[model samples]
Target: MNFVGYYRLPPVRGVFFSPAQEERLLLLGCQEVFSDRCLAGGVVRSGLDRALTALEPGGVLAVPSLHALAGAMVDLLDVVRRLRALNLDLVVVQPPIDTRSDAGFFEACQILAT
Candidate 1:
């Protein structure tokens, strides 16, 4: 199982996760982690784009949380859309999100929207 991690940091310097979370992801077998630093509420993410492009079909993407994907709901939805289009599965550590199932996918989108 090929797994990848995605995360973001607020442009100003904010830490969203502790070492424990990273350790957990490593235990879950995430070999690569891609992170982006962006201003609050900004949608343009180069790291995200690169991660998406690097991921092959049926790959798994691990995120710490929905909020980490984007500060704005629109950007969050866009990220989800791109992930869906790529046929990549999303595993959000917090809130236990998995986009492999229909309900899970819907719930992930809902969580990001709200």
Candidate 2:
């Protein structure tokens, strides 16, 4: 479904996506605009750690792009770490990252160089 409705909505609360995340999510085709992955209507929560697991089940993920690539790495790492902890599958456009393989991490590190 086109995400026109979602992108148009004013952000609700907590850490909503940046414009980039909205674009990525639009490209990924989310059926609904999820504020965050909450459990029991906020009684329990996945936070970033468990939240990213949704990616494997067809959630399009996006990490913030800082002023520069180097700056962005920290943000990217946090995103990756969270996703990795959840064992979520991801598709990175710039530098390919496969947490399962050392080679992928090594290669991605090189590719991510600013």
Candidate 3:
């Protein structure tokens, strides 16, 4: 299975966090990295859109944290639902979530519920 890394950072604050996030994803075995540096309030997430569109059904999407993936919980839930529908897995670094195994999937669900 292929692994893709995605992250979103505020435009002016990404100088350090962006590279660190990329390196972490690389260490986690992600082959491709897609990033967005834009205002947090902006509705467009071109990088995330591209990553989702490019990843195949069996591929995985890795992100630093839930916050980096979405601006709000509603959006996060929507993305998670889409990922599930697409048969794509997700690996989150912070809070250590993985949807590849039964226990991990359970843990992810618990986290999402809170």
Candidate 4:
């Protein structure tokens, strides 16, 4: 399956996050994975918009970690809502959450609570 992915790694950390994430996605049998790494909430990422537009119907957005979406829960929630409207599945790898199921919904709520 084709996937568009998004992630963020703090610049201060020096270590890159995308390499590991790309490896994971590739191992998952993803034919293609488009990703962008940015500082969370630092700026509007145009790559996300392009990725969303590139997504085929029923395609997935593989986010290796949920926190990469935003630093705030509200921002994350907004992103989730918008992605849902586009009928794209969000695959959050670390916690193994998929927004396509009830369990995922509950897990998401749990994450938002923290």
Candidate 5:
């Protein structure tokens, strides 16, 4: 088989604060399986649980970029931040290094490369 033929597992998403907002995020989200409080309920925890269940193990959770970091952030990096804030374990892709010190960036890249 050609190396190009390979595909990766899917990403999952969740919403808990607002319905319309959540739906919109899902529709516009770069990842698969978006959950909004409108469709899932009013609980953010429930939305998170649902999204987690739908996610494949070791898959990444994607989210919108923060207003502050928008210009310097990537779609995948934003998701990783949200996941970390929510206390989820995910493989953060293309994470930003501006927040890091010079030593930190060097260490992180070394770890990432491995």
Candidate 6:
């Protein structure tokens, strides 16, 4: 199984992924990193699409935070559903969520429920 790192910069002016964030993902054993810079009022997430497509069943997707993954609750849920359908795991470094663990999985569900 591979651990792939993904990050996104909001439409604001900033770098793709901060050095420390990339370092953290690397420390967590991520083999590759994918990133996106959101365009103002844009809905396309080509980077996320590529990352998901690159992973096979049982692969892992690591991100710095939930907000970095998606902007809205519905979008987040859709991403979670896709991860489940693809048989992939998720690891969020900040706020520390790991769907691979029972407690973390429950926490994820709770977060989504709210």
Q: If scored against the real structure, what TM-score would every candidate get?
A: 0.75, 0.35, 0.80, 0.71, 0.30, 0.82
Q: Model 5, 11-32: lDDT tens per residue?
A: 2254223444334435543354
Per-residue alpha-carbon lDDT of candidate 2 for residues 1-114, written as tens digits (9 for 90 to 100): 222112222224663445665566456554433333223333222333333433454233432222211223655555445544554444433444323334365346446643
- Please report, as a residue range, the 10-residue window in candidate 3 with the lowest summed lDDT: 101-110
The Cα local distance difference test for each model comes to 0.73, 0.38, 0.80, 0.67, 0.35, 0.80
lDDT of 4 by residue, 22-42 (tens): 777677655566554555447
**Pairs in steric clash, model 2:** none
Let me know the TM-score candidate 6 reaches against the reference structure.
0.82
Report the C-alpha lDDT of model 6 over 1-102, residue by residue, as the tens digit.
367988777776655556777787789898877777888886477878888988889899999999888888888888887887898889998888887774
Question: Which scores higher on lDDT, 1 or 6?
Answer: 6
Q: If ranked by TM-score, best first, what sequence of candidates would result?
A: 6, 3, 1, 4, 2, 5
- Model 6 ranges with Cα > 4 A deviation: 14-17, 103-114
Ranking by lDDT: 6, 3, 1, 4, 2, 5
Distance from true location, Cα of 93 in model 5, Å: 11
Stretches of candidate 3 above 4 Å error? 13-17, 103-114
Better of 2 and 6 by lDDT: 6
Tens digit per residue, CA lDDT, model 1, 21-96? 5676677678867777776666457767777777889988888887766677787787877777787888887778
Each prediction's RMSD to truth: 3.8, 9.1, 3.2, 3.9, 12.0, 2.7
Lowest-sum lDDT 10-residue window in model 6: 101-110
Q: Who is ahead in lDDT, 2 or 5?
A: 2
lDDT of 1 at 33: 70
Better of 4 and 6 by TM-score: 6
